[model samples]
Target: MLATAVESTSAKIIAGSDDLLAEILVRSPVSSLIRFKCVSKRWCSLISGHHFSLLHTFRHRRSKPSGLLFRHKPSLHPDATTAPESDFELVQLNGGVSTAPSLRYFSFIPGQSSVSGTIILQSCNGLLLCCSFPFMAGTRRRYYVVNPTTQQYIELDPPLEDGTSAIFLGVNLAFDPSKSPHYKVVCVQITLRSLYNYRIWIYSSKTRSWRISLESFAAPFDMVFTEGVFWNGAIHWINPYGASLCLDVDRECFRKMPEIPFHQSNLAGKSCRFFGESNGHLHLVEVEGPQTTQFQVFEMKVDYSQWFAKYRVDIGGVVAAFPEMIHSYLDSGDGNYYDFSILGVHHEDDEDESLLVLNIPGKIITYNFKNGNSKELVDFAPAGKDKRLMPQLGCFDIYQYSETLAPV
Candidate 1:
């Protein structure tokens, strides 16, 4: 009887150990867990499941972001500074606050070139939706959904039929791996002739096809660089008139959200405003003062009807913190000099530590909101050959991206 009890206790201990191991594996980074999936069939099933993916995302979100992904596409213009053979390049900036961060070249799945696209439509769940080069005299555009980490990609066909005259305004990716492996590629395709020509097409991975709808208000007037932001089961883009264009991912329908309030003067510049998401809420970064030194960040209300002023940052503080660093804009001969504008904000895991990435006339500065300190992140002029690049100039597109093992 004692021998039998000993064997039962040992079996219980073994089962407990297995349970603990599974828990630990689920918390591991997607890149590491993906390789472990090959260990056994059971491990593969567990690691690939929606639940595991969700857990992994949540855990990683709590940690500092891994690095930034930079996409460079030189201009094809005759007068552009870049060469015609300037093949598209994707760069990875890998490191956290602890390690020395550096940029490295990344290779896509062989034979595939990402630079063919005009804009990186959207990035969701480690997958990127890029709008391909215009074809048929700008009448059609192809989109490629790619996983940079895995170097795998899938090209999505045009969502319209033959002779359906339409212009693709903007594209966004809706992918929540915790719900399913399948994802959705959404585009705002507008037929210019008609007042009601604004429509949205959603491409479903499960169906392997596209579906278009015109169920909501007219297409948003402004679907520029402030691409759609995915939040609360919907994708959102700022409308120039005030309201926002929202498309429900699950319901596959379009709706209007309240307009974002911006200072009247900010309406002057085409690239004056910026949109982003942080801690599950939609935020807008607006240029406040004439000098552009002051910025007001607003967080959308939970109901999506209003905005609350969240943080107001004075970039001039950076000048005081780093007195030795000379800003080019300070020497402008024009009496009216453009002030530094908020390009982006990188929030840290602790919530208290966040960096306000700003753009001056000729450089980039990262100011720590928590510590009230600042440092030069990059200079557009002489930092390096690849420095000072912007998508509009046909140079490069830079955004904050996390590293993951999300397969194409």
Candidate 2:
């Protein structure tokens, strides 16, 4: 009788207000909520509706944007000396047509920032955490967290006087929009090749002080710094050198995860390393490699110990379409492909289950997972085609529900 009444309360709350439902459910027991969703059809639908799904996406799918920093000549004067501007963007993977011709992109330029350049790392939740080295010599470098949509930014004081000489550094950003007001930031450092030289530091909102965590890594491994994706209870990073390891922000300790399967082909001679968050867990995808990516999708399963083949795609000549290109793989495990909100409905299909390979040359080409179809979008590319410029590889992903939300 009590279970039935509690279930009724959940249903009423969900039907009343999504924010109210989330606020109530977030603090409730996860097991009880899972059981409540299975109580009745109306309850199930309410929990699975767009609002509930979006709240779930924010809880589980919050992610950082991925982009590259490169030098480009804004003008076409053979000897033009235009200093390179950091071209940053976020790639949201869509489950609909994979090879959609036109792509969507969000550009990031440091506003009124003293110095900004291409981003090297990101934390989920659409924040590009970056290092902007001084535009001039002998100056300090500033680190920033910028929300591309809102254009709101937070800059950190420069680290040790000679940050250039520091051996290893990692930044962990916590995304708890509930109490954080602003997410918490942590900076980790280890001396160059010095054992037991590990240190953890955090910038708090309440006290506005750098607090060092009590926990530490006994023997830190070599790190390839990217955004530490916040998931489950800890944040994960790609430690490609050996097995994967993560930090428990609450506990502040590093723990190893099951190894991600690697193919000989991927390690042969790829130029860039690739890894992305789909749903939640971490997955390593092929960025650039000798392997002719005959298969486009693979999953890091269970606990990152094995790889599962999900789907396959080919852009054909699409690589030649744009002067700028990027590839970021996103995983679609939600099983909600029918909700075409943005409705990449640019064109209709002429053939049954027939996919369209990008007719032009460019870096990215997506695929329609269902019915094996593809389409091209014109909106998310460089403005006006310049025949001379070749779009080099950058980052790409499918649009998810969280990204479809009003940008901020």
Candidate 3:
């Protein structure tokens, strides 16, 4: 009877401890989950299991904005007029901070000491797709998919070329941890000889291979391929000159989106526009007038056949609120009214939220539409504290990123 009672008590204790472990695993971040794996054999199995990863991703699906990723080459040369080299450096400014934000350099590249020719392409979920510089020279380029947070990465073979002089138009990373651990990378390549012909290639992590699409579409010469967004099961790219193209990731098909209805008077003979995605809907931001503070935002309907005007924010008010930004713009004397690009929406879960991220020339600023408040997030001054290099203006690229555990 005594032995039976003792066994029963031990079983109860183990069950209770497991219940507590499950609670913590679901709530912790990816960084903590990785470290917790070494705590015990049970934790190593549970935290690294496929099912546990899905559970953790779902629990924080609505996570707040975390940081902004920047890729640029500092001007290391003595002459300011001399162009910066292709050795781009990646940095991040923490956006999730409750106090003052801080800057962090990307220190987790695989074989950091010797790797070169790497270009940061696009980010999806938490993974980044990077390519080597040789691709631009009409040669095959190796691609690297990396997750900086967990310091894990995988390399992909170069896409097959048919000797048509293909140019890598863009790449879009697609990942949803709730669905599966496997991820996909879609690359768009445009032919220089046949200006109208475009090619699509996709790489799957599960298969560890590249699949080329047999479809072809007419593409414009001024296509905006660098800043493509993956949304609604498709990768979309918009050129500021009133043209948009999308590729369905699963079907490997291409289609055109509805033209943006910007009034000629508002455009003032210039096609200054930006594209962004929020809550699974594509957004188009256009300048309303020259030297005017008002800007218009339009959202695409579910059918993707039409667009509806969503919100109009007085951007001039936000800029004026910050005298420094106003002085900086006015001092430039460039007279370009549309000097900023709408990055993305922030604080989406709150009904009273009207915060939008704006990318200025040398810095990023957060503007709240509801209250017309503006604050600077990062300043990319030419001469940074690092004595070896000074960042140049033409090569800066920024993206709003959220924390995720989606593997490469």
What residue pairs clash in candidate 1, if any at all?
A: 242-259, 291-339, 380-388
Please, what is the TM-score per model?
Answer: 0.71, 0.54, 0.75
Writing each residue's lDDT as its tens digit, candidate 2 over 302-390 gives: 55456675545443323333322322222155321110111111111332322222212222233454454444432333567642243
Best by lDDT: 3
What's the number of clashes in each of the models? 3, 38, 2
Residue 49, model 3, lDDT: 63
Residues 1-408, candidate 1: write the lDDT tens digits: 999999999877754674555677867776687689899887777666655655565556433334444333333432233222323322222222322122212234332243332445566656667654442343355567876654557877775468663445666788765565678877776565665556677788889988775534465355552367776778887655455667788877766676677645556653446677654556787564344456667778877777887777765677565433333556566443344555566655564666666654344566776666777654345444433233332112445555555545
Instruction: RMSD for all candidates, in order, please.
Output: 6.0, 12.9, 6.0
Off by over 4 Å in 1: 1-24, 34-64, 72-119, 134-140, 163-167, 178-180, 192-196, 220-226, 263-266, 269-271, 321-341, 360-363, 378-396
Q: Whose TM-score is greatest here? A: 3
Which parts of model 2 have CA positions greater than 4 angstroms off?
A: 1-83, 86-120, 158-168, 176-182, 192-197, 214-222, 240-242, 263-266, 269-272, 300-307, 312-364, 377-391, 395-408
**How high is the CA lDDT of each candidate model?**
0.57, 0.43, 0.61
lDDT of 3 by residue, 1-408 (tens): 999999999767764686566766779877677788899888887776656666677777655435656544432211122222333223333243222112122235443322233556666666677654441233455567876655556777766568433346677787655455677888777755487787777778889887777446677777777777777777888665667788877777776678777754445554336576665556777765345567667888767888887766787765565433333344357654445556666535453565667665566677775677777776654654531123223222554555666556
